[model samples]
Target: MTAIVEGRSANRVVAAAAASIAVAMVGMAYAAVPLYRLFCQVTGFGGTTQRALAPASAPLAQRIGVRFDANVAPGLGWTFKPVLTTVSPRIGEQTLVSYTATNNTDRPITGTATFNVTPESAGQYFNKIQCFCFTEQTLQPGQAVDMPVVFFIDPAILKDKQARRISEITLSYTF
Candidate 1:
């Protein structure tokens, strides 16, 4: 009888431990996404661009071509395109570019943009000083807006052995 009682108590402890582990796993699953996003932003992992308040003080002599691409997700009822197809700016030089977005629906719709730099290695070197993507933009029916993005290619890119040879970087945005 004592053995039976002890066996039951041991079973309860094991069950409790299993339950605790399951709960902890669920919590970690919930936390993973945001934590991963923060990690990518900080490290510029997987093409995520960095944010900065200002560009490098002095621009570099070598010029790099930057191509812009814009896209609107299906069902967003929005038209979006880059104002300029491309620009050649010296490394570390601050450049301003614009994108146009128009609302096709009768009701106001809000949009947020996500951007990335191609040649994934170049992501760490792409910095945005100001961008419409930082906040959600709301447009009324038939409303068209010109959104600006100010950015620079960090001179540090030239120092990275893998990224040094990249002559052109594509910055793509999706709304």
Candidate 2:
């Protein structure tokens, strides 16, 4: 008679099930990175972290009032007409911004957008609560849509006191 293994109960089916469960659990653990990133982006729970197209130099303060600019680049057949609202928070407040995108191309176009905050000093405090950047945007010929973003600055920023040194903030968008 063959000697039975003591630990596994000599059952092949039981071993197979255990192996599958282990594999499945390992797979889920590996997927945690992308899953958590998706959750952050969708809910804006953490400080909005996005890959910067290129390293941006720390921003310089102009006057006491910070001046922010919006730079947008639409896809080959798309057009962007941004409608930005003025933000004058006490350096620790939330603001809303809106943009209008139009499909001027003869053919339908679908693409995504990515963005960054310049003047590393400002980026630390800038937070995007709601945005469409880095998301797939589908536009049909002559189709236009309004995109909105909600953002807020951490109150801790003011505590830095150095934050007051920052005047203008720029929120640029590139498609």
Q: What is the C-alpha RMSD of each candidate to the true structure, in Å?
A: 0.9, 8.3
Predicted structure with the largest lDDT when compared to the true one: 1
Task: Give lDDT tens digits, candidate 1, residues 1-175.
Answer: 9999999999999999999999999999999999999998988888899999998569989999999999999999999999999999999999999999999999999999998899899999999999999999999999999999999999999899999999999999999
For residue 40, model 2's alpha carbon misses the true position, in angstroms, by: 14
User: What is candidate 2's lDDT per residue for 1-175, written digit by digit as tens?
Assistant: 2455654465777889999999999999999989987765543334334322222333223222323344446335677756743566444344567878788888888867655554445556666667777488888989999888766555445556665466665666666
Model 2 whole-model lDDT (C-alpha atoms) = 0.61
Q: Report model 2's TM-score to 2 decimal places.
A: 0.57
TM-score for candidate 1, please give it: 0.97
Q: Which stretches of candidate 1 lie above 4 Å from their native place?
A: none
The models' CA-based lDDT, in order, is: 0.95, 0.61
